[model samples]
Target: MRIFSTILDTVTQRLMSEPVRHDPAALSRIRRAMIDLMPKDANWEDERLRHRLLVAVDPTSLWFLRVELHQRLGRSVGEEVALESVQALWPLFEDSIEPALLGKRPGRRSNNQRGDTPPGR
Candidate 1:
């Protein structure tokens, strides 16, 4: 049993470290699933949208969304784009997941945060 456990652990670690390659068909299917699951004309400001995304969407689908977005945008898969893509794909999730996952919005600058550019400059 101990040997079996060790083997399982080793396999799991290797799989986790490996990068996932998503084919075009797989990406298409994932996008379809996302669209199907999305609630149309529903109030996005409600917390239920965030909860649904967290619970309904599987981890694999989410990962593929990020990868597809990064590749399509021709940007390196960094933490910022990885997250921004998700929000862009699902506006219902905007301002909700980012604050919780990243502690703030990416690429959004407040007027005060912007360097002094003179009033109405």
Candidate 2:
């Protein structure tokens, strides 16, 4: 069992360290989808994020932005809606990010973790 654990750790590390090659078109599509999800009455925060997404040159930047994007969606739409929308975007990152990273939404905390229910819940 110890040997098996060591092998698993090694494999996981390799997968985490391996770089991904993303297609330019895929990036564009992801940027577009994120922008489209922005609320119509977008504030400076929205514009700032939009610009970031537009100028992002790597999957890492976009991946980090997912948290902010989910927050914006939750504030504007709702938690359920935001979760669904963000989950929909996960496939777009499948080819450009590690599967381990994409396994869960970033910045999310369950009611037990947060000690408070989500808005409208």
Candidate 3:
């Protein structure tokens, strides 16, 4: 996982270094996406601020963060990018956002906690 993270980090950095990163519209789009995707809870304050800061100081990290968030929320990269509005993506991620805001891995909620019957039952 560390190796994969490293490779992703490198690639994201390279991609972010392109001329498109300097475009005002592109930057606006990224900022809007970050704000829209961030959970509305105090628990995620630090993480949200960190990502916002990265958008200015290290956009590659911000890009990777968004990618991870999409993955954890179970949205394909293509689907996420293809959406006409960031709001459209939020509903799809509603189930996973709380866990993510609480610093927990999404989808780790057991069936028992979700009130679902056990596998053998």
Candidate 4:
């Protein structure tokens, strides 16, 4: 069991250190999805789950996500939601977040790698 644990830890560390290439289309879509998602989901009203998501995300990402949320729900909802909603909704969103994030990328390993941005307007 100890040897297996060690192996798992090593693999986890290696995966963490790998670099991902910049993907403009992916980042754009993610940003758009983040915006579009804010008001669509009913569970986002929970406070505890909201904060946990915020805590786990990068600050820049958090800021953008929050802005998206705030724009739709308004300042009162955004300011107060994290105080409690994050805990309640934590499991729902967190469980699938890693896959959702990686799946959004445009890398060959991404689920929909062939996805392309629309032609220039």
Best by TM-score: 2
Highest-lDDT candidate: 2
Which consecutive 10 residues in model 4 have the weakest lDDT in total?
Answer: 112-121
Residue-pair clashes per candidate, as listed?
0, 0, 0, 12
Full candidate order by lDDT, most accurate first: 2, 3, 1, 4
Candidate 1 TM-score to native:
0.24
lDDT of 2 by residue, 29-107 (tens): 8888878888899789989988998999977678778888989999989998987787677667777766446543466
lDDT (C-alpha) at residue 63 in model 4: 30
- Against the hidden reference, what TM-scores do the models get? 0.24, 0.65, 0.32, 0.24
Query: Clashing residue pairs, candidate 3?
Result: none
Pick by lDDT: 2 or 3, better one? 2
Candidate 4 per-residue lDDT over residues 2-112, each given as its tens digit: 999999999999989966443444444444444434444555453443554334334235433543454445543664453333223223333233534423343444233
Candidate 2 minimal-lDDT segment of 10 residues: 112-121
Q: What's the lDDT for residue 91 in model 1? A: 33
Write the residue-wise lDDT of candidate 1 on 39-106 in tens digits: 34445432353344344344344533443344433333455544454445443323223242332347
Candidate 2 lDDT: 0.76
lDDT of each: 0.44, 0.76, 0.47, 0.43
lDDT of 2 at 97: 65
